[model samples]
Target chain A: MSSAARLSPSAPGLSGTGGHDDRKVPPVADMARIIGLSIPVACMPDVVANTALLHGYADLVGSFVLPDDCEPAYEYVP
Target chain B: MTMQGHKAGAALAIAADVRAGHRSAVSVVTDVIADIEARDTRFNSVTRILGPAAVAQAEEVDKAIAAGRDPGPLAGVPFGVKDLFDVRGEVTTAGSIVLRDNLPATRDAVVVERLRAAGAVPVATLNMDEFAYGFSTENAHTGTTRNPHDTARLAGGSSGGSAASVAAGLLPFTLGSDTNGSIRIPSSLCGVWGLKPTYGQMPLGGVYPFVASLDVVGPMADTVEDLRAVYAIMAGGAPVGEPDMGDVRVARLGGWFADNISTELRAGIDAVMAHLGQDRVIELPEVARARASAFLISAAEGGNLHLPRLRRRSMQYDPATRGRLMAGAMLPAATFVQAQRFRRWFRDHVHAALAQADVLVAPTTVGVAPRIDQPSIVVDGKTVSARANLGIFTQPVSLAGLPVLAAPLAVDGLPLGIQLIGAPGGEAKLFAVAAELQRAGLAACRPLEAGYARKDS
Candidate 1:
């Protein structure tokens, strides 16, 4: 078997990955805090569509029934 | 199907034992905790064990049973929740310290409520990648969730902990959310059965969102029957009644699903088909462009949701994830909008394709779990980003919001599974077909026993 067929404790890094070479960047103590809660990359369309869906729903329900948090630009609280 | 061996630790067995007065619910739950404590130290599958609450809940279940009330389907069975999901009285950490001070959730996520109603006890909040971002559960914040078969390798993520916990018998079944294959990848890596119901099959109210459209909640279990039981309760829809298994038909997806898979994966799929004596192979339409479109939408929306946080605390995320999110933030708005339009087009196209087949079959993941510390995957001698590789088979399906079940192939010794994709709202049919596969002995569904690991050379 080739060398790649053998198992290692930690898998090797990619053979040619040069786009972003910031491997030596300083580590942040609170990564989530620094990164902030970004929406998951997979859910963008759903969020946009859902926002529109909620907006359309709001028009029918009127202002009092909807929480201000339900507005078009409401940040998703995880 | 009558309790054949130790591998079949069915909820039915536990219930039977309790009804026969051999043990109490408290005893079963206490033993499950002991099992987790003893085994998890080696597996590191669980992030946090819910000791006190589980014990108290077990006692309450025992009391209800004593009062002669049937405690529903999962009565007194112990299970775990993916940490991203909120549990009342506990902070939904989503595998990061940023939410350490967040107040406890006031209500259980809808799935959690359903499980509780069925008398299943919550054993712990399992680990995951920070905010369920990565495919390999090598959470810089919480440490990686290791595969039960080989501690040195990854437990596929971002539902890595759920799969690991179940694979290690820490919980017989657990709930996980999938956005582009989190639930399925881990389940495949850990050698367990998992289902990602059609989008919105189970309520998504209390779970932390990854990609909202692609995100879905489902169960991961040792066997398809257990998965069926948990899924029935979790779906909160009237039980799919009894599945009509005899009439079930399996379709092998050609096009994208057939290409780009590891040789090992192809071998496994071939073995599953060969064992059945009835195999159908067809070419499927290419899905790469749609997959990329899904990725574009995931990035743009995710970046926008956390734009303020990204701006204020850019240094806090795992460098790998932060860089990706940053790229998303730079994505033009029109591209993001166009991706959605493309999703509609893709969904319509797939719907037309499915009209020719009841369900599409493909490998749940392109390959086995990568080593936990790896930064990328090498497929066909070409290396790809580890995150992107994990979403290979899952994204196209999730983009269309279709239902899929990742069924472990019993004949394969490695942790590999096959994806059975059904039309939207076809979870019931998916489960029935999975059950037939399980009964045929082509797929087996018992949790891996403790201390079972494949040693590396």
Candidate 2:
């Protein structure tokens, strides 16, 4: 049997090896509701990845890149 | 002692007398068992003793040794397996009353089998949080597992028994599983060494599940070498032979690792970094969110695993663990999926970042072990869950399925440790770094006060 079969309750869960399958994925909005922590702007990439395939939404074509002046730290080459 | 005996002691520094024929494994085990009997009343670390069976196993090892047979490296060594592990013919109570009348395991856990294959003998089942959920070992079912350093404080959980047993010298080393800092938290709190090897490097068969995705079995000992030895044996890998600590390149994880930790813990990390002469601190991005994501995944998966039990036997579990598991059960499946997906992204990012660094350092626990009922401590002027704070530095790494060693750092009288994390399947590298830390006076492990003396029979 495959490793997935060996695991309990074929839900899409993180494997011991740190990979994931499309089994029983936990709901994103519900999790945020439970955690109740602010979503740092630093987490945009994670948010994008987590939402890409939710409810058959395949492509997130918009660019979230900021203008060079948004943060002077990365604005220009020294 | 012969060569095999020498090999056994090499890890714990107990080999000198054994090799010199001062005492045999049988005698050592007998003395340790007696000590446990005397100390466990106060410590409550050992749930059930395998006295007769353990004695018999030790005698068998002695007989084999006398017959001039080599029993590999761990022959005759007294070891403890956490209550969550199945050890054939013993009730795997998992520190709960629900399994009080459960049948004994018909076979040993894979880790136990591997240890036995190397000639190690199982002595007792260590205490833990019921079903390995909580960080403090305040098991309402089984009495709390106390810190050996300060009985008034906790030994950190769900590997509380394993950590306490090793810290108290009841056993030289013990097996433990980490879902979220279960192994490392207690090891730090109790002033011993605990390794959470890269996930899946050690087999999980015969061990009860906590969070299937995050649970991993490793060993806790009083020394890094012992941790390495036990890891090699349990994982079915050959030892890295002799450690070459001089060549280790250390990584001091700053940013999220540095900001929230306590002054004492930060001092410990700083001391170790200075001693290693590679104090360049590197930022590990996304660690904060990663840790939060890990908590989300652990709860959702753990609840899913025990949903039936929660529905029927809710009252059986410790109230703290049961509540969390129930909440996890309520987590919409999408969030759990997002957490796992986030884990995939985080793992890849961590691997890429670690390619330039051999190991990353952080405080094993956010602060020192707290008194069992001491409530909460102020961290950065904010009040957090007393139990959750202890595992703050550890949860993120465990989520990434990376290896980590909670190696003790020097503290005045209280015990504190720094966590050394490495990429997946990097236990050998983690140990090599730990050995270097020990040499630099950043880490030390000593056997607990001699608990009992050998009785001449």
Candidate 3:
């Protein structure tokens, strides 16, 4: 709710952004485990911190809507 | 030949001489290799000089000319590739320690092979953001590629080395990849011609994959003609020649593309529009959302590519890229799906805007290159990291899958540029407008020394 909590990934009170996330964004530590279950404990901190930042950006993208008929731009001749 | 060392010579200048049999390709290669050795220390643009293999290729070109056979279109022109592109017998580092031990590529990237077939000698591998992930070429392993125009400033890249090398006049032309403005940002900062061709139009074979969907390789050069010529070969012969400029319907991009621009840059774009006699201005809807989609898609895709490696060697990546890829790898599928779908809608809007004009012009960067010590630009009056936010104008355009030529504006002081956007597969129309500006002296490549000369001491 406060500016500091919104910016800090470590803050537990950070809520869903733009009503796009059904659940509160995962805590940084939880995101690290979500990426690689067996990832080294030491690497988790960086992963969590990074994942938290990415989730912040993903929030911006999640707000936009597209029709289901719009196909992804995946190109390969084969 | 003087070799034009740091004089910001054009690739077309050398190709003309070699094509005419006036100068031996062998001699040109020898001199260029020697010149880069002599002059590249300042910019640190070149990572490794090809040496023996390049010399041998040059000799073959000389033999062809001596034997009365043509030496090809780019004959004897020395060029470089971003280290991510495979060069035969060289390890493609992609600016990381992670790939230092990977075996040498058995062959060249498809585009590299195309250039070689056209007689352009690949003399070296240039520096880049590790895994082509960062906007600044401040490679932790390879060292930051200092702007040749001013050693203390950022060159603005992932393709920093490619653009810097051209700006430094060490190479006439170079190859670089653009995902989220990699080529365009660096080209605009370093003041060279860079083309990010229509997405999926050019072959990506043998180049290291970053964001598979958005990644596109293109050429950077000191002259627009050379840029188009090299592109012709890369796109599979001579460009359908330059198109008629009179037929092009040009308009300046307004709204998101116009904010936070400097006065000099504003004048430069104003001059360009006046030169074209196009006073029209068009704005696309939801550009901010389009940029966000491009960003998320790139992160998710780039993260997925490096996920396996990160799981094993997370500590090895540049900390900046590591976190990004990790975040991307963990991005929810729903988010990625939303980004992709939004990409399609945003692209349609952009294309629809293009239907009214043959080309859309926007400032490549918010302003000039940022100083190295203070590596931030004032965007919308807030100082932000130049590395992450350099693509503000470019990222939105990338979503459209259109061809954009990064045209350096001939303004005073540090290098600045404008983006000339064309409709899908409309490279020729963009080239026509770019050529018209270059001819009118409104936009021209300002080599490093030329920019430094213009700098206020």
Candidate 4:
């Protein structure tokens, strides 16, 4: 891939206009509710902003195609 | 007793002086404590001084030497720990007010125990980002740690205090945990030597957990030699053998690693490549995705670790940390799982890169330390938060679980650094390259002048 293409913003979640499936991922506030977190009213804006940022990153990671045989990197010995 | 001109081997020299009765450990510890008390006001690097306990430990070392017994290799050298490490009889705050009321630790952290056993004394607890979450050490509970070279700029963190203390010559060495660029970021910005050892290499017992899958405790120091010596003690005292410089293969990481760097930093890397007589540049695939995976995993793990406490005392946590943790806790499980699976793929590719070269070179941060008032860096023509974006280079490397030695570049202005990356358990190779750079005058920690202190406040 060209450097310009690589540097271009690729996360649809950040733009909220294309390629994001809203039906699959709930809104930030709704997700918080489902997870049983009581985000404070004053803190909600920052929480939403950070969550939105993570959503973009999550979209980027989730879009990558992985082989079925791939396993999580969780094992650590000594 | 001053460490002005003794950056290269301060720890070893201090140990030799103590063991040979040239200086008493008690006196050394006392002088360090006094220096910290007198000099740390401008930097805000040291949060607590382990005065009485450190002095008592030094007395024991003195008695051991008097009885014709070995006091250990790092005898009487004073060091500090990032506030997350548990020290017996002290609260491990992890740099937040939320844990201020917690009970005192019953024992030292495993790495701290190792250092203490080796005759090194922990003289102070240094400042850090709350829960080791941020890159810039602008702690909400403790004030920000200022860069020693120029107090107006930030001392990159979550190991900001650890790096600053060493850079300022307050201590010969310090211990810090690196999950994602914590040690490397601070070390680079403060112009010190730091090692982010391979994952799972250092025992984490009694150390405050950050990201379970990623956390690795290591040492920061004023010189490559001191860093190696401290790392040996932390890694169970087996001395790391030096690799032949002639046989060590070097490559510069291009692709994502080559972007957003300053002219000075670019020149620095060019000089290093020239010195090694190689211009081979290796580009790793999917580096953007690798960095993203690390970010996701860290957030998810760190959020889960603090969920119980955050649930009870949400308001007590740092506002910046609390918001991010809550967001991480709410992440879809599928996203977290995908990140983990992608990590395996990324690690495989990184290993393949290592097969071609023994060591890979990259910049630790894009530029020098950001200004304190404006805590941000320009990336791809956009100004972003330094706290979140400074780790763009280091995070991807952290995902591969490689050992990276952050080496300070010898420059004329504010300090810059480069990462010498090696395969897992390839720290000896990293150390060899760092020593070569230091010897060739291509890399060395810039010493802060004695009169350099914050004048604004």
The TM-scores, one per candidate, come to: 0.81, 0.82, 0.91, 0.95
Which lDDT tens digits does candidate 3 get at residues B20-119?
Answer: 8767777777777777888888888999999999989989998888898888878888899999999999999999999899999999999999999998
Candidate 3 collision pairs: B135-B157
Alpha-carbon DockQ of candidate 4: 0.57
Interface RMSD of each: 15.4, 17.2, 4.9, 2.3
Which ranges of candidate 1 are over 4 A from the true structure? A1-78, B1-9, B274-278, B282-286, B373-375, B450-457
Writing each residue's lDDT as its tens digit, candidate 2 over B181-252 gives 998888888888889887767788899888877888899987666778788888887886544656567878
**Sort by DockQ, top down from the best:** 4, 3, 1, 2
Instruction: Please state the CAPRI-style docking class of candidate 3.
Output: acceptable
- Compose the digit string of candidate 1's lDDT tens values, residues A1-78: 232221111111222342243332212222323445444545333333333322222222221122333322112111
Task: Mark the regions of model 2 whose C-alpha exceeds 4 Å error after superposition.
Answer: A1-78, B1-22, B241-246, B452-457
Task: Give the top-scoring candidate (TM-score).
Answer: 4
| Candidate 4 CAPRI category | medium
lDDT of 2 at B101: 87
Model 1 superposed RMSD (Cα): 10.2
| Pairwise DockQ winner, candidates 1 and 3 | 3
What local lDDT does model 1 show for residue B208? 81
